[model samples]
Structures are given as C-alpha cells and as structure tokens.
Target: MGALDVSKIVQGRQGWRLITCIWLHAGVVHLLINVLCLLFIGIRLEQEFGFVRIGLVYLISGFGGSLMSALFIRSSISVGASGALFGLIGSMLSELITNWSLYANKVAALLTLVFVIVVNLALGILPRVDNFAHIGGLISGFLLGFVVFIRPQFAWINQKRVAPGQETAPVKRKHKTYQYILWLAAVVLLIVGFTVAIVLLFRGYNANDHCSWCHYLSCVPTKKWKCNSSPQTCTVMQQPNTLDLTCDGTGTHHSYSIAGATQDQISQLCNSLCS
Candidate 1:
C-alpha cells in the first residue's frame, strides 16, 4: 500500500493523512515504542481527564506535528505516534504548571516530566529521527493543556467535610486570560502555517521526484538508475561503476569489468536482465 506522504498531503490534498499517519509506523519496533509510551502516558491521562480529552490531545497534537513536518519535511513518508506521545508529555507539563496548587508534590512531578521530555527530545536528534513533529506537537499540546486539562473541582474537596446540604466551593480556576490568549495564538499559527504550506505546494514548489539530495532513505546510494543519473554517477566516495547496455540489429550486449563494475552488481544486474 502507498504510504501517507507529503506529496499526497499537499499535491493530492489528502488532508486526513495528518491524523491518519499517527496510526502508521515504519516497523514493529516503531509501533511497540509508541504503544508503550501511549500506555504509560495515556493511562494516567485517561484516569485523570477521561478518554475524550486524552483523545483530543492525541489527535490534535498529532495533526499539529504532521502539519509542521509536511511544511519542511518533503522527502519522508513519516509514520509513528511519537508526535502524539510527545504531545501528551507536553500537555502533562503545562497541566502541572496550570494546576500547581493542586499537586501534592509539584517539584517531583515537574522534574520527572521534564526529565522524560529532555531525554526523548535528545534522542530525536539521532539520524532518521524527526524532531520537528516533536516540537510542533509539544507546542500545540502545551497550549491546549490550558483549555482541555481542567482539574476536577470535586476531587479537590474534602470528602468528610460534607455533612448535609452544604456545597463545597470549587477550586478557583487559576487559568489566566493570558493563558487562553496563548491557546488562541497557537491555533491561529497552526491555521496560517497550513494555509501557507498548501499555497506554496500548489505554486510549483515540490521535492524533486527522486529527492536526490534528501538522504540515504530518499535515494539509496546503490547502483541503480535515477533521474538523469545513475547511483554510480553520484560524486560520492568509493562509488562503483555501472554496466553498459547496448541493443542493435545484431543482438543485445552487456559488458562488465572489474574496473567499472563490481562482481556483485554485475552478477545481480546480469541475472535480472540477461537471465
């Protein structure tokens, strides 16, 4: 099956992929890592806020990450719920800050969450990792945390204090107006970012069909043919030579030599073509 990719998202307008990509993964390892993180973070969040808000955090944060990834990452068919997971982590941090008065051990909670975020973000700097999505989801989730992760008032009140019809005053909603403005600002930025990316994509800006300079993933620097060049033709170190293909009235001819062609490429290509 075709992967959820930027080409389809932008050029084909498959807007659903922003969320759908979270459900895809490169391999079993990718899937398992995401599942573990989701389980750890999701379970806690679900118990606190229920499924609805947690689900919103996952999806909205995933979309935020994917949108940003699409804007700058044109060559990869990125898949994984890392963005969504990171969003949960981000929202957890913001939630702690917004509800600082509620937590029994605010310092410990903040430190643990901060340590998790730092380690994950540090790992993202490795090759083949996507840090952009992490940052995007993080920002989006942090802003959204203010709006979605409202502390339950009843949970904060003393259970034994109630004797009769007397009502317990709910915890003061400490969410400042500036915090809400920040949330709105995040939403506006996301909308504008997506709109501009779509416009640029339609205006003829596209990753080269082969993504020649993108990375080893985009063009597997092997003895293969690509647009206007062969893998061997790339001015890279220790690149082997290519096989010669000639067809005339006489017959098809294939030539190989140690100088230009390696034994493996010659054997493989010859078997595929001549055999």
Candidate 2:
C-alpha cells in the first residue's frame, strides 16, 4: 500500500506495482497537489476529448513515468500522480499546437502554458521530487498528444487545401510534407533519447558529475564537498608547506593517505580531499 520500489520492479520483477503506485499518494499534501493539478489540466482535456481519451492519456503517461523511474532510480520507492499531472501539462502544449489555427491568441496562450510547465519543472529541483517520472510522462504525453488530439479536418487521413476566398468543405487544411517529416523526426529522436538514457542509467553515470550541461539544473557548487571514494589517513609532511594525497586499493577496499601538516599546510591538505 505504500508505493512501488525500483529495486522490486527491476530485480524482484513486480511489474504490477507500476500502475498501482500511480493511484497511491505519498501523503495528504501530495494528494492535494495532484488533485488540484488534475482538476486544472485533466478537466479541460476531458471536456474536449471526453473521459475515455483523457483517461487513456493519464494512465499511459503514468505508466511511462513509472517505467522510467524504475529504470533510472535503482533505490527509490516512488508514489504519486504528479507524473500523470505533468503528462496533462505536456498534452495541453501539443493540443494547443495541433489546433493552433483554431485559437485567436495563440502566442499568449502558448506563453502562459510554457511558463506554467517551466515553473513546475523548475520546482522539481527540490530534494525528494520524482523528476524522472515528470520528464518521462511529459515526453510520452507530448508525443501522444499529436496523434490523439488531431482534429478530423487537419488530420493526416483527409487532406484538402482551401484558398482564402473559396471553401467547398467546412474546414480547409492540407497535410503538409513538413509536418510528416517533423513528426517522423520527433519519433526517431524520442526512441534514440530513451535508448541513450537507459544505457547511461546502467553505466552508472551521475548526472551531477558526468553531465555538465545539467549541472545548472539540480546541483549546486559547495565548498563542503568531501572525498568519499576512499578513506583518508594523514601523515606529517617532510616538506614544510606542501601537501600530497595518494590512493591505493587492495581487493575491494580503497584508501587514501594525506602527507602534510595542519595550520602550516591546512588549506592545501583540506583542498586535496575535496579536489
């Protein structure tokens, strides 16, 4: 009843937990946030597409979120509908774009939607947030939105272009060659990205250290960092003002020894550990 643990999903092979975890909430506060977000985003989608389509999007996006969390976070037990909430946000973005011609103030609506999505995702930088789920749900929802929300006229199946003055059909739209190209490109990129992400996840890549571009997102430079790769032992330095650290490993255990004096070369000694 708690949540789905990544280890169980991976090593224990409890796949049913993926969907079950989405229905569970971490706490009352978490439940409130998801409910509010669902009301805001889910209701509108349901109004337009009806209950069935929106429901499918929510569940599918949530499942996608859980799948990514299981793959990336090996030690976490994740619960909540926030991933699905982000999915709704993503769906709205694609919906707006797919039906852009129908809207009068496209730019304003788009800006507002983008601002909200950015703010929510930025807030995910906080500790304990399941950002991987949000990201997975978002990408899945965005891609699905294009296919799920296409209007009948502008849809690829029926293509007809009408001039400014003359219109035999109620809606005048053409299936442009570029739209098909872009959609194909998006699918290719999505598959490639997911594959790369899985490879890096198994490679034990720390986004904090390995991906410098993402350093600005969730990591902050701290002077209090300590060397955790090896245990340290200090030795009085023969030299008066210099410090040196050496590392050695035997079997599985690793050790680091520092050769230096305190106060005389304290800054250098401490800096060596952090560096």
Candidate 3:
C-alpha cells in the first residue's frame, strides 16, 4: 500500500524477498515499462546465447543490481527488473563492441538503443529512480557476457603416416588467456562496486551538528539568546594555562588553546568525536 509496507515485503524476514521483489512491480505503469524493456533485450540475447545462458546472465546481473541498490540507497524503496534489463542491454553492447567486424551494421542499432536508454537513465538522476543500481547491473552484465560468451581460437597440428602416404591433422587446444583477463577485470569491478556500496550505506547517517568536537573547534560561537540551547553552543568550560576545555550536548570535553590546531590534530579530534 505504502513505501514502508512495500519495503517490509521486499526486505522480508531472511532477505530472500529481494529476488521476488524485483519481479513484482508496485504499479501497472512500473510493470509495463520493465516488462517492455525486458522483452526487447531478453529476446535478442536469448537468440544469440541460448535461453539458459541468457537466464544465468540476467539472474546474476539482477542480483548485482539489487545488492548495489541495497548497500547504497538504504532509506529508499525500489522494485523493478529494469536493472536486469539494462544488464541485457549492456551485454549486447559489449558483444558488439568486442567483435565489431562481425556486427558492423548491428553497431548502429546497438548504439541507437544505448543512446535512448542512457537518456532515460540520465532522467533518473533527478530523484526516485535508483540509477546507481541500473548502472551496477549494466556493468556487471556486460562484463559477464564479455568474459564468458566469446569464442576461443584453436590451433591445428599436421601429422604424417608412413604406411599409405596418409596425412592427418591433430586437434589443438584453445587458448583462454583473453577470457581469464576478462574474468579478472570483472572481479576487480565487482570489488570496487561493493566498496562504493558500503560507503554510500553509511553516508549522511550522522549530521555535522551531531558531532560536539566539530562544533567546538570549527563552528563559530553565537551570543544570540537561542544559541545557548542549540546544538551549536561552543562555550569554554575551563581555562588551563596551555589549553581551554569546552563542553556541548555530548558531555565529552575537548581542549583548545590556539586559534587553530594542526591538520593532524584536528583530524584526530574529529575521529575521536565520531568514535
């Protein structure tokens, strides 16, 4: 019914709800948009890489998208398959980019699709939409497709038989160096992605006003009647020969003497406040 209710359903008790939530849309408009995009991209990818492989790519990419969104946008509620759809689009683009000679004509079509989707994604930066999740899904899908789907090159060896002047060629092994490189790159990207997600999770959790040390050292003291009761209060409580002690909302006190402290000392004080 509401965002909170939906969040509860999506978050669930054990967190398995994320998988279903991605498929379940909040409204008709949301369902239609995501379904249309999925149909367009999924059909093309299935044709190229068979149903099973395409399904795998979609599932993994979707998981990556949801994981990123959960880590980064903690307070917001999201439900859509757009992230997976975008992943399919990214896979198609990567395939075309890697083998341009084989798909020269298709490049124009792919580029047109990318342009349209990118414009739509750009619009998402305004509010509601989890553009970050879309981006994570797209990148993960592209990387997975590139790493797993490319054809390998094989070498042949010739052998001669003395009996009847017959010659045969021995099958040679295919090299997988390129695939290994791709996998390595994917791992690196995923690691970086998760790190960003962690950073975003904790961002803006505590406002600057909540830190008494910062208020004491950085914020200018005000003499207004309302200032004393406010969190901005920075009055010195004790005067030592070398330093001045101060108190704020948090009883933890700090000492300051000079007009300004060194960068390292300021950093240490801020860290203590946060801790």
TM-score of each: 0.64, 0.66, 0.57
lDDT of each: 0.65, 0.64, 0.57
lDDT of 2 by residue, 130-218 (tens): 77788878877787677567654344333245456653544334544444554576567657766675565445443433332342232
- Ranking by TM-score, best first? 2, 1, 3
Rank order by lDDT, top first? 1, 2, 3
Please tell me which predicted candidate would have the highest lDDT against the true structure.
1
After superposing candidate 2 on the true structure, give the runs of residues whose Cα lies further than 4 Å from its correct spot: 153-179, 182-275
Compute the lDDT for candidate 1: 0.65
lDDT of 1 by residue, 107-169 (tens): 999999899888887666555676767877887787678668755333445644566887876
* Candidate with more favorable, higher TM-score: 1 or 3: 1
Clashes in each model (backbone N, CA, C under 3 Å)?
Answer: 0, 0, 0
Model 3 Cα lDDT, one tens digit per residue, 26-67: 689988988887887788778878998888778777766776
- Which stretches in model 1 have alpha-carbon errors above 4 Å? 152-161, 165-275
Error of 3 at 202 (Å): 12
Say which prediction, candidate 1 or candidate 2, comes out ahead on lDDT.
Answer: 1
Top-scoring candidate (TM-score): 2
Scored against the true structure, residue 122 in model 2 reaches a CA lDDT of: 82
Error of 2 at 222 (Å): 8.2
In angstroms, the error of model 2 at 152 is 3.8
